[model samples]
Target chain A: EAAVTQSPRNKVTVTGGNVTLSCRQTNSHNYMYWYRQDTGHGLRLIHYSYGAGNLQIGDVPDGYKATRTTQEDFFLLLELASPSQTSLYFCASSDWGVFYEQYFGPGTRLTVL
Target chain B: GQQVQQSPASLVLQEGENAELQCNFSSTATRLQWFYQHPGGRLVSLFYNPSGTKHTGRLTSTTVTNERRGSLHISSSQTTDSGTYFCAIGSAQGTGSKLSFGKGAKLTVSP
Candidate 1:
């Protein structure tokens, strides 16, 4: 099983506040993804990376920027957080692109007031 | 954009009963996956059946790429199985790892 971890399991920030969510995987997976889950929206991809320093835009990329500093680390930055950004964010990693199963973190619940 | 649709927005089943969930995709899915989400919010991969059929324990998943449809069957449901089931299809638009997810089927099992 792949071990994926996230920081600050829960977060609260005011509108316009800057927030960053971190994710790390120990399986040396080459693919990493960030997603947000809303009641009716399910899980929407925000960004993804296949390697360190590489980034790919997903279906829902607006207001979100991501960086893969290392093969084991990925970060999502919200420079100007809004109440709409409040969601349960999940980070996942896979050894291969779409061929393999992706392991997910416990999730981070962000609340923007 | 790829679209994944899951049916039975919500389901209720008693212990020992059988349950079935469906997933239909808008385009050809080279990678289809089923996930079970714990009430606490962790996602556990249940199956990765892009084609054909795969089974593990009390769960079975069947996917027909040509039809762009898939189904998940669970037997002997338990209270612990109460949560949400999500069906996600990988999109080839980008790195091929990007997935389009359906809203999910909320299942509640009672003892």
Candidate 2:
């Protein structure tokens, strides 16, 4: 199975604070994604990358930025955090050809005060 | 924009019973997947059935692409089976990495 891990499993910050959520996948999957889970929104994609230095905008890209420094690492950046941006974030990875099945990380719970 | 809708927002079942979950999409989807997430845990892929039927363990997933709908059947439910089930759909024209997910169906099994 693909192993995806996220750092700082839990985060707390005040408004205007900058936070960075890191993700790394050992499966070497070409596609990596960042999603936020909310009470009624389920999971909404924020950004995704197909390979190193490749970035793709997702459904909800506002107030967020993402970087894929390497094939195995993807990061989500919150330059100015807000309460609305506080949610459970998940990082997932999947092979290039097989995009339907994605392996997810444990998730990062971000709380903005 | 694409949308996925799951029916029976919440369900309660006794152990050993059978449970059925439904998913409906607003647009044509090239890929459909079922995922299970325990409370406060990560989401795990249960089935990747875009069309036809696929079975694994006691779980069965059937997707009718033409109908833009899918169903997941869980037989012999257990207390451990209690969790939220999500249905996600991917477009055929895009990078295939983007998936639109449903609000999910919360299932609780009791002994």
Candidate 3:
């Protein structure tokens, strides 16, 4: 079965801290994405990668940076975490063109206090 | 601009009853995906149909791409089916392939 795994299921960080969220996909999909979900707002894309070494900005990418280290791994970095960045973050993978169903990870709930 | 909007915000259903959720998009989408986020917070992909109709088990998804709308229907819903249903899609592929999502429809089932 295709699976997307995210690390540190939950975390609490102080303001001005640096936080990094990691994700790995066994699906070997060409596309990987990071999104944050908050109350009243649906999941919004932060950054996405087409493959290793490629990154694309989304609607909201102000305080986030992402790196695609390998086909199986993607990372989201918060250089200076803030209270507003506290939310549930999900990592998803999909192969474009012929594939459309996106596989999402369990998600990481980060609280920046 | 708001790209996608889901209807009912939330719904409560009785076991064995049917449920319908709506997703409307503002931009032209190349494709659309329907996801079921279980109460526990794990996401399960339900459908990936850009247009027309498709079904799996007790769920049916129909997307009128031309009209920029999609509908998901659940038949004989069960208590385990309770969760938030999300609709996400992209305007196109490549650099601008990021999916814009709807707020989601939260469903609660009572036995």
Number of the top candidate by TM-score?
1
In candidate 1, residue B105 scores what lDDT?
A: 99
Flag regions of model 1 displaced more than 4 Å.
none
For model 3, the chain A TM-score is 0.96
Per model, kept true contacts as a fraction are 0.79, 0.56, 0.58
Cα lDDT listed for each candidate: 0.93, 0.91, 0.88
- Regions more than 4 Å wrong, model 3: A97-99, B93-96
DockQ of candidate 1 relative to the true structure:
0.77
Which pairs of residues have clashing backbones in candidate 3? none
Per-residue lDDT over A1-113 for candidate 3, one digit per residue giving the tens place of the 0 to 100 score: 67899999999999999999999999879989999999889899898888999998877899999999999999999999999999999998888622466778999999999
Ranked by DockQ from best down, the candidates are: 1, 2, 3
Scored against the true structure, residue A112 in model 3 reaches a CA lDDT of: 95
DockQ of 2: 0.61
- Predictions ranked by TM-score, top down? 1, 2, 3
Q: What DockQ class does candidate 3 belong to?
A: medium
**Model 1 - which docking category?**
medium
TM-score per model over all chains: 0.97, 0.95, 0.94
- Docking quality of model 2: it rates as medium
lDDT of 3 at B1: 49
